[model samples]
Target: MILYIKYMVSLRCKMMVKEELKKLGLQFVVVDLGFVEILEDITPKQFEELRKNLAQSGLELLDDKKAILIQKIKNVIIELVHYTDEMPKVNYSDYISEKLNYDYTYLSNIFSEVKGITIQQFIINQKIERVKELLLYDELNLTEISYKLNYSSVAHLSNQFKKVTGLSPSFFKKLKEKRNRNLENI
Candidate 1:
């Protein structure tokens, strides 16, 4: 049995889902981002119980095909920005189209209808979030972050960061440093 789950975006979420499945005594073949495969088929009663159990943890079981596809698109973008080490050589549209096996036009239309934003916008948002995360960690310099994220140049990265966040990357890094120092002083 395969289950499509919504809001399973992080490793922590995967762990929580796994724990819930174990508590329900379900045997899972895999617990991946936004999907779980079970070794055995579950009864509707068992499915309902699992659904309710997951809901308690802010996860949702997706039965609608459209919803499942939307979640998949989100997951793929999330993985690309936050998890993958190497960015694809091709552009995002080509990469996403290839990865999902859907024509870019259809995917774009459905995604915009459901998400109220273009896929490019979503990718930029996810990239900005990743930049924020990297800035917070303070392990990578602006140059390194820009390179890691496949931005053409540091100026471009800074421009996008300022555009999306209303703050320059250096300013953001300083603010994070200030917060960390304040915590340490406490």
Candidate 2:
């Protein structure tokens, strides 16, 4: 039996879900970001117990098809932006469509309707967050960060970063450096 889980994004969440499944004596074949495949069918009592337990931890057991699809979409984007070392070479729409086995238009419409943001916007937002993370790490220069994030040029990255954050990338980095210096002095 396959069960979809909402808000199971991080490795820590995965661990929690695994522990929950073990506690319920539910043997799982796969426990991924958004879904789990168990070796045996879950009973109604088990399902309800699992749902209540997950809810206490701010996670949800999803049953609605549209909600499951949306969670799947989110999981894909989260995995891509936060986990992967490199972005895919193909267009984001094509990548998402292929990954979800759904038409791009359909996915985009549903995602926008449910999330109140277009998929492109979501991708850009995620990219900007990733840029912030890279900047804070201070291990990569702007040029390197641009190339790593697959921006066409540093100027383009700077423009987008400024647009999203209202602060230039260098300024954002400076803020992090200042914070570190203050902490060190403390």
Q: Give me the runs in candidate 1 sitting further than 4 Å from their true place.
A: none
> How far in Å is the alpha carbon of 102 misplaced in model 1?
1.0
Task: Give the alpha carbon lDDT tens digit for every residue of 1-186 in model 2.
Answer: 999999998888899999999999999999999899999999999999999999999999999998999998988998999889988999989999999999999999999999999988888998999999999988999999899888999999999999999999999998989999999999
- Which runs in model 2 stand beyond 4 Å of their true positions? none
Q: After best superposition, candidate 1 residue 94: deviation in angstroms?
A: 1.3
> lDDT of model 2 at residue 20?
96
